[model samples]
Target: MRFFKYILTLTLFLALTKGYGQDLDKVDRMLSNYPANPSSTEELANRIKNDFSNDLERVRAIYKWIALHVAYDTKALGKPQRVRFSYRTLAELEAKKKQFRKDLALQTLKKRKALCEGYSTLFQNLCQQMNIECEIVPGIARRLISEIDRQNLPSNHAWNAVKINGKWLLVDVTWAAGWVDYSKMKFHQEFSSAYFASDPNEFAMKHLPDDQKWLLTDNINSKAEFASQPIPYKYFLGKNIKLLSPQKGTINMLKSTGVQFNLQNVPADTEIAYHFKREKYGQKVKSFTKADTLSFKIYSELKGKDELVIYFNGEPALGYKVIVK
Candidate 1:
C-alpha cells in the first residue's frame, strides 16, 4: 500500500512539474557542454561574439558559461574587508578603486571562485567588453526560509540589469551558478536559468532592490509587499500553487492583515496547519471548508518581525513574514 501511494505521489509531482522539468533539462545540457576557463575573458567573449550575433543569444551563452564554470566563495560572505587603501591624492584613490575592480575580475576569472559581488562584477565587465550595457544592482536577498520573518537587515547580495535592444532585463549570475550549503559552509554547484531575465513580479518575491528603478517592470512591488510575500522558489512554480492574499508574496499588515492561498488536488483527509512565533498554532486556526482555498488571520502580540508558515501533512509548503510595528 505504501509503495502504491508513493507511485501515485510521484505521478502527481511529474504531472505538475512537466514543463519545469523540460526547462531544467535544457539548462542542464547547456551547462554540461560549457567549456572550462577559456584562457581569458576576451577570448571567451570573442568566441561567443563570433558564434552568436543576436544580443539575447550572446547573453544566454555568457550566462550559461559563467554559471557552470564559476563556484561561489563561501568564506567571504560576512568577513571583514581585506583591502584598505590610504591615498595621498584623489587621483591615487581613483586609480586604486579602478585597479581594485580589475583585481577582483582577474581573481574571479583565474581562480573561478567569487562571492555574489564578484559574480555580478565579472558579468558586468564581460558585458561591457562586448558593448552590452550592464549595471551591477546591489540589494537584499532572502537566502533562507527562516529569513522570511527577519527585519532591519542590511543589503547582502548583488545582481545585474542589462539593456537588451533598449529593454532592461534582470540577471543574477551568482544564483544561476549555484546555492550555498550552510551545514558544510560550501557551495553546491547547480544551474538555475530562472534567474536569467526573470519576470519582475516573480523576481521581486525574494529580491528587494535598493533602487526602485531597477524593479525593471511596470508593476512595481512596494517594500511592504515584498516583505509580506512568501519566498518565491522554483518549487512554487513546479508544484503549480496559486497564491491569493498577500499578493506577490507580500502582505500589508497596516491595512487588512489577512492571508490566503489556493492549492489544487489536496487530499480530503489532509488539514491545513500554521506556525507563528516559532510555535504551532494548533486548533486556534480553523480548517478550510473547501479543499482548494486556505485562509487565516494574523494575531500576534509580538511587535517586530514574525513568521507565518503554512504546512500540509507536517511539511511546510509556504511561508510569510509579518512586521507588527
Candidate 2:
C-alpha cells in the first residue's frame, strides 16, 4: 500500500505548448542554480523578471523555483486553525486581506514549507509582483479512491490560475512541490512540472473549483459528475496514457456483462495487471493493442463490492469502485 502511495505521487506533467513554442528546458536549466536566500518576494520576482523576457518563461521560472525549493508542511495537515478579521468598510476588508496574504507568503518563504494555501499564496504574490495576473482558486481535490462518491465534500484545496498572453492557465504548486508520505507523516521534495499551466480539462480530474468560472472551460462537469469521475493514480503523470472507456468512477457490475477498459497511447512494452480487493495475487490481464489504443476486460467471477485497481508495468495507474448486485 505504501508502495502504491509513493507511486501515486510520481505522476508526470505534460509540457504545455498550446500558445507559445518556447523551450522550457532552457528556462529550467538557466534557473537551475538560483540562490537559496531571497529577502522578499519582490527580490525573487525581480530576479525572475530580469532572467526571462517573456511572460511564459517568467511564470515558469516562478513555478519551477517554488516547486523545487518549497516543501509541503505535513505536520499542519488536519489541524484546523482560523484567524478572524474585523473590517466594517469594503476598503478596509480588502486592505486586511492583502496584508494577510503578504504575511502568509512571507511566513512560507521563511520556513520553506506550507500547505496548499501557503503555496498558492506565494505563487500568486510572486506573479503579481511580476505584473502577471494570478488568482488563488479554492476547490476540492480528490486523490484517494475512498473519496469517491463521498457526501457533502467541502473545498479542501487551493491552487492558482495565471494569465499568460490573455489566456488563463492552471497551476497547483502544492502538488507540484511533492506529496506526503502518510505512513511517516513526512514531506518529500520532488519537483514535477505537470501542474504548471496544465490543461483545464485534465486539471479538472483531481481539482473541482468551488467557482465554475475558474474552470476555464464551457464543458465543465457538475459537482456530482466531478465527484463520480475515475481515480487517476500517479502512474498517469508523465505518461501519455488516456482512459477511454468506463469513464465513470463507480461501475455497476450487475448491469454490465463485463468491465472493459480502453486506454490510448499505452507503450507497447508495457505489462498490464489487475486485482480485486479480496484477491491475494494480481492476475495478468492480456491486453489487445491496436495502434496506440489498448483494451482489456475484467470478468464478473470476482464479484461483490470491491475495488478494481489496474496497474501498468507493475505500478498502479487507475482505480475504480466495482459494485455487483
Candidate 3:
C-alpha cells in the first residue's frame, strides 16, 4: 500500500512536468518557425496553438520574446525611391527581387536596404506567418525640407497593429528593431518588445495605426487633417533652453533661438510642438496638436514644460541622426 501511494504521487508529478515542458517548447517553436515579419499566414495559424499552450504564461511570454528577439533599424531606415511599393504584393516583390526563396525580412535584415515600406511589409509578413493579426498604417513623420531638396513635402510611413491579450496593440517591429552599422553598410537586426504591447496614446505620436479605430472610441480620419505642411511658428517662436530641467524633463523657450534641444531620437518628419494645457484648443486642436519642426527657440526663457511625443507624419522617427545632448 505504501509503495503504491508513492508510485502514484511520482506518476502525477512526472505527467504535470512533462506537460509544462511541452508547453514551453511550443511557445519557442511558434516564434522560431516564422520570420520576424508578421505576414506568414500558414505559419501564423500554427503559432496560435502556442498562444494557448499555457494561458498563464501566454501573454507574458509572447510579448517578452518578440520584443527581445527583434531589433529596430535606425541607420538603414530612410525614404525608398518613389517607386510603387505595396505590402499586399510583397510576395510579388520577393519573386522579382530574388525569387520566393528569400523573404523580405530575411533579405532586409541581411542587407539593411529597406525603407519604411520594406520594414513594415516585412514585419507584416512575419506576423502573418505566425498567425499574428496585423495591419499597415500610413502617417507623416516630418517634412523633407533639407539642403538637398527643400521642396519635398510630407511622405508616408508604416507599422503594425497586433492583437495581444485580446487587445489590438500598436507595434512597429521596424522601429523596435534598432539598427546596426557594419562598416559603411548597415544591418538591421535588433527587436524591441515595448512597442509590441505599446499603448495607442503612446504609439500614435510615433506609429499611427492603419485604422484609427485601433485607438479611438469613434471612427475619425485623423490623418487627413494631420498638417502635412510645415508649421514654422510652433518651433520658430519658442526660446531655446540649454538643458532640460531636472524635474520637468522638458526644455522650454520663449522664442526660436536655434538652440538645439534634441527631442531625443524622435522619428523624422515628427514635429516637436506642445500647446499650453490651459489654452482652450477648439475641436480641431483639442484631441491632438500639430507636428512641429523642433528648432532652436528664438527667445531663451524656461517658463513651463509641455508633454512630448513622436508625431509621425511622413516616416517613422527612425531617421534623425542628430542626438539630443
Candidate 4:
C-alpha cells in the first residue's frame, strides 16, 4: 500500500505540455535512468479501480501521499518568480542538464524536481488517463484577513479542484508539501491535509482558484464575481449577518418574516433563532422543544438591518435573510 500510495500520487500529477521552455534533455535522462512503472499506467489504473471501489478511500490515499511525499519550498515563499519549481521545471532543467532535448514525461520521472505547475499538470493528466475526473484550476491567490484592497504578492498559484462522488473538493498538494529550511537544503515531511476538502471560507484565506467555478460558494467573501470580474464582499456582510452567542444570558428566537429554518440543525442547549426580517412579515416565536425555549431571552431585536443574524454551534452556519430593512 505504501508503494501504491506513492505511485498513484505520482500518476495523478503526471502530465506534461508539449513545446519548448519545458526541460527536454532532463526528460531524456529521466527515461534512461528509471525503468517503467512496476505496473503499467493502464494496469495501475485498473488496480486502483479494484482497490478503491469507493471514491473517498481512493482520494484519501492520494491526499495522504501528496502531503507526505511532496516537500514545500520556503525559498519560494513569497517569491513570485519561479526561480525553482516541481516536476515541470525540473524536467526543463534536466533537459538543459542533458543539453536542450525535447522534453517528455519519462524524463520528468528521472529527477524529481517539479514546480507547482508540474505537480498539478501531472496530477491532471493522470486523472485524465485513468478516467478520474480532475482539473487544474488557476486563480488570484491571497490570504489577507481583514478588508484590504491589495497586497504586493504573486497572483499566480495553481492547485487542483477534484470531483469526488459529485462533490467538488479543494486540494493544494503544493501547500501540503513541506520542503527544506531556507538556509539549508533538506526535506521536511510534515504535510497538512487541511487543504484537502477545505471549506470555501477557509480556502479564500489562502488560494484563489483561477476558475471562479471551482469556488464552492457564491456566498463567500473576497470571492471573484460569478458572472464577470471579481466582487470582493464579506460573507458576513449584507444579509450575511452572524449571530453572537449571548455570553451573559440566552436569547430567544423571534420570527417577523416567514423564512424556512430547520431547528434541528440549530445548536442544541442554546437560545432561540428569530427571523426579524424576511420577505414577508408576521412571524412569531413558537417553542418547538421544552428545553430549547427555556432560559432564552428575546430582550432585543434587530430593526432596519439587512438580515437578522443568528448563531448556531458557535459558528455562522446559515444566513437567515436577504435584506432586513
Best-fitting candidate, scored by TM-score: 2
| All candidates: TM-score | 0.68, 0.88, 0.41, 0.45
Candidates' C-alpha lDDT? 0.68, 0.81, 0.40, 0.43
Better of 1 and 4 by lDDT: 1
For candidate 3, write residues 63-122 as lDDT tens digits.
434444444445545534444445557687765654332365555545444656666665
Looking at candidate 2, what is the lDDT of residue 280? 80
Give the residue spans of candidate 4 off by over 4 A. Answer: 1-46, 73-110, 143-152, 179-187, 221-325
Pairing residues by index, what is the TM-score of model 4?
0.45
lDDT of 1 by residue, 1-325 (tens): 5335434544543443342333544544654555687777787788777766566667777788888889998877778756889999999999998788767876788889899888887888778778999898999887565665456657888999987766677888898987888888989998877687765555666788899788754344466655655775553433434455555343435424444455454456655666665454532456464656655554555456666666666655566666655
The residue pairs that clash in candidate 1, if any, are 228-250, 228-251, 229-249, 229-250, 230-249
After superposition, candidate 2 runs with Cα above 4 Å error: 1-19, 238-240, 254-258, 299-301
Please tell me which predicted candidate would have the highest lDDT against the true structure: 2
lDDT string for model 2 (37-152, tens) is 68988889899999898999999999898888889888889989587899899999999999999999988887888899999999999999988999999999988877777747
Ranking by lDDT: 2, 1, 4, 3
